[model samples]
Target: MATETPTSGSADGYYDFHDHDDAAHLHALGYQSEFKRDMSPWANFSLGFTYLSPVVGVYTVFAFALATGGPPMIWAFVLAGLGQLMVALIFSEVVAQFPVAGGVYPWARRLWGRKYAWMTGWVYIIALLVTISSVVYGAGPFIASVFGFTPSVDTTIACALGLLVLATIINFMGTSVLAKAAIIGFTAELVGALVVGAWLLIAHREQSITVLFDTFGTEGDSGSYLPAFAAAALIGVYQYYGFEACGDVAEEVKDPGRLIPKAMRQTIYIGGAAATFVCLALVLSVTDIGAVVSGEVTDPVSAVLEEAFGTVGARAVLVIVLLSFLSCAMSLQAAASRLLYSYGRDDMIMGSSLLKKFSPTRHIPPYALVVSAIVPAIIVIGSRVSENAITKIISFATLGMYLGFQMVILAALRARLKGWVPSGKYTLGAWGLPVNIIALVYGVIAMVNMAWPRTPDAAWYDNWIVALSGVIVVAVGLVYMAIHPLHDRSTAPYDDAIPKK
Candidate 1:
């Protein structure tokens, strides 16, 4: 592995190295100071926020939720928000203790061992890459809507590829540009959510608040609203993620141990609020809620927005949504590249040397960034063969992330049971054990909810794809690990990074 002597301070003193505090912390955890630490607290927060991307998350899945469970689906946001807050809290505890890039991968490694960490990283990296594809594909129609063009499969694929290329360029520009773009995207999404939501509530609302409780007779095969509601809850499940992006870029953020945990919580708090408000506003503004539930109007959010605002007004909103999509793709790519870099830095993967190479001038992992972009672009192109490409791709992303999350949380729980105690500045104190258990429960429930085959009338693949895909991903990772075990396990020494009392 390449090594650099830890410097005492930056020339301008902008970094205030303080006896190489950050470098020391990283070295204690078996890593060198490879990434440039330019991210401020807000920048770190912005990366997580943009990855969550309320506008993109809600807009992309809005119509599907409305069609599945009608106005009552809005409550899914509330339930999901509470559930995910538990997961985020658990994440904060681990991230504060480890404060490593690649998020769950390194966390699991420290808590468990090499095999667990390998699977965690493998699943997470795949999820992050596919999430880039999902976000780009989700944005395609909004871009088309803004330009007044019809979104056919051909057009959507073209738009998705264009987005992948643009986001890759921003990532290659390095952390500073990525941070600035995240802040810009966050501002647009926040402002758009508040302004659009308030307008829809004040000027366009045609339904009562009570409307959110009505299922409109859309129950599942069991003839119970419970099953359909579980399926519809996917909207909220999908949105609350991406907060882990903060941990993925931990090495790039200043004072990460102190700041990343707070940033993770804030991402969920702010994102959950914005998403709930916007989804509620859209549901309430619908003139004919039955039409939406019955699939008479497939894209209910757009239909309502066009009706509430005039054509020009709706087009303006579409532009804001498009920006959110662009930023979402950018953040996903950035996080994925960092995960690749982390795996490579530890010599865990096949192309460690190349993947771990940092561009001296750019101070970023150029090859990893390129691989990140290419994989997602290929996924987008290949998805064109599927009739329900968007839904299935989104399912893959949500399932993959949940599986990765559960693995890390489970590892942490086991470690805790075995007398592990957090040594970070932000330990959860007396609440750690309870929170970790609850978080694991929520993760399991959410994963099953997302992977459950809900569409009985659709083709078998459409129904079972999420569960089957998840199994296939796990199997592939295990096969690779069995054939080619990691070259070195010396980093296991750093397990002492979290000292036992």
Candidate 2:
């Protein structure tokens, strides 16, 4: 057992200023520090919040949801929000027990073993990288809208690549700058959600509250609203994710055992409410619902905003949405780079040494950051070659992330069944078992709902891309694991002094 140090500042007086308590906790987990602990509690919250950016998530999928299911699709946001809250509870428990960086990878490793951990990390890192591309590509149209330019394929690709490069530069500046930028993003998103949502609901409301229940007569020949409504639920399912980014940066957060768990729950609470509210406001504010559903007005959000606030006011809101997109990409890139660095630290990836190398002066992982930036840029460029590239990439990101999340939850639940008690300060006690089960159930349902083929009229690949892409990612991981099996390289036994109970 490792002895607990006194709660007072260290004899050298440095503990009062530096995060010596967090350092001791890391030592107890058998890890040596390579990153600076500069993230405050709010900064940690901001990381998860910005990654779950309501503006970005809602704006990206708004038109699709509206067109597919009309105003009734807002219910999907409510349902998915409740389901995701269950998952967030499970995540908070696990992260509290093992507040290590790389999020699901280390948590799964601690609960299960090395092989499972490798695959979990593999899926998660790929999801995050592809998420960066998805977010950047989603932002392209809005960028064009703000600048009063038509968004051609070439212009969209150029804008995405430029945003990626800028975000990469900010990430290279180190955690302090990254945390500050995240706080700015959180503020902008929160303000936009409240101010814009309230303005739309108050000044330009066209639809009644009853409209939320109506499917706008788009149930088609089937006459049942369930299918279209469920299909539209994809927007909410994808929006609720990105909260796990908090755990990915656990090593840099102060007193993460307590702070990170709180951050996760708060991220869900604030992000879910904001997204639901914005969706409700936008749905009610539509000047012409028939036009939106019929595709006569392609961009309902901009159209509604321009009708209520004029083109100048709509462009002003777009500026904030653009910032949300940029911040979201930055947060995703930061999480992906940290995950790479964590895998490299364990010699689990291809370029372990180089990827794990931290800059001495800047205190950032340069190579990992560079790779994170470059790969997403390449994916954006690939959009020029394949017409369906962005759609497929977004599907991969959503499915892959949910898969990784469930793997960790399942491992934790299995460990619990075997008497692996949570010994962290933030344990759920009697509530842990039930919450874990509900979270697992929710994850499986969401995964199936997302992967099920919805587009019958489209080509075969377009309809089945999510399922197909997921299988490919898993097969590749399995093949790599078979070729270069990981040996059981356990860390020093965890010291009990870190956990409160």
Candidate 3:
């Protein structure tokens, strides 16, 4: 990485944050948000699209819809998938411009102002924690099912907390360390998803393609044709979420302005196509929904494999999934830590002085990683009280992530409309206006689907206990702000100069 360079005066130009951050800016007494750029553009892109991308996001709802919404689940997936493209385009626009660590927050900050940026940042932060809870909570049964080793809820919580701790350590080691592990873990997740998908496709070659593509039908507790189909598309939307991770880590890439946008476009196309193929393989492979959903079969992909292959064969696949998901949890925790580190530098948390303490030797935000682990550890404990509540909370919390995503699009739109930033190395330029409008429309629709309460049996309403946390966290942020007036010029949420953070 290059050394820090001071401010440059433009003889003829107006104001703008410098196009890049200096690595030496990271060396400070209590602040360390700077990241070393070492990732290849491909790794940068796939890491987001691969690991934390939710398979359950696709499966949980669509599975529920299978019975009633006979074949139209494909349509749901199709439309929702298209909706995601709107958000993805927005990100393509932003990362091409500001390529900073504070993705949605930065864009919102640059567009709306500091206060709004902080609110968006906090919402995204809590949302990330809630998703962490869901991912860990869901991973538990897979561990037990594959190993035939059972543990009480309390023990499961401990294991989950331990995993959180491990991830915290890995992430705190440094951006390079975290990024390297992500590459390996991402490769595993990609291979695992494909191998299982391919096996199912080959085994179920006899099923009619028309069963999936021919028509749409209502399955299970799904209400009406159009609404249920709308809800089902949501499943695919969830699975493909998180590819914007490429944008958040752009500051850590060698030539973020160029590479980030390239990765952004490729990640979506590659990840989207891969997921489409997997879903096709999966729906075709299923012989009976009744047998699959009968038990606590959380790892449905593995379950399908087991049905096709023998018990021993399926168990091996289950092991692969268990390991893969565990790594995903680790990767997500790392991202959460860095995001919190950025927030801390911006004085979003109390004792802002402490949270940004970077390790001199390791080049990491140790305190920020520690802070990131605390809420999640508590969440892991809370999960024991009610597994269903935890899962619902995570799902509901994901809406904040969706909100963050929308802001990124909003930022890109603002940049194009206002023409305030530098001419970015990459751009939507002319297409920016139309793309942002479509993205905003789709974002609103998806949020409503998530917000709309469904029947108690429907996945939307099924785990609602956890979903309310988004409101709770936002309310908490307000209360916290009231107590400690929000002023931290040293770590201004936006406004370049890299803050004093």
Model 2: per-residue lDDT, tens digit, 404-443? 9999888888878876666555667778788889889988
C-alpha local distance difference test of each model: 0.84, 0.82, 0.61
Candidate 1 lDDT, tens digit per residue, 211-328? 8888888894567898878878779888989899999999888777678888998998999899999998888898998888888888887788899888999999888888889898
TM-score of 1: 0.94
Candidates 1 and 2, the one with greater lDDT: 1
Q: Write candidate 3's Cα lDDT for 348-461 as tens digits.
A: 667767765667677666876776678877877876666455435545765778877776566555645555433445545556677788988888777766765555675653
Off-target runs (Cα >4 Å) in candidate 1 are 1-20, 220-222, 487-494, 497-501
Sliding window of 10 residues with minimal summed lDDT for model 1: 1-10
Candidate 2 residue pairs that clash: none
Count of clashes, each model: 0, 0, 14
Best by TM-score: 1
Q: Tell me model 3's lDDT, rounded to 2 decimals.
A: 0.61
Best by lDDT: 1
Residue 430 miss distance in model 3 (angstroms): 0.9
TM-score of each: 0.94, 0.93, 0.84
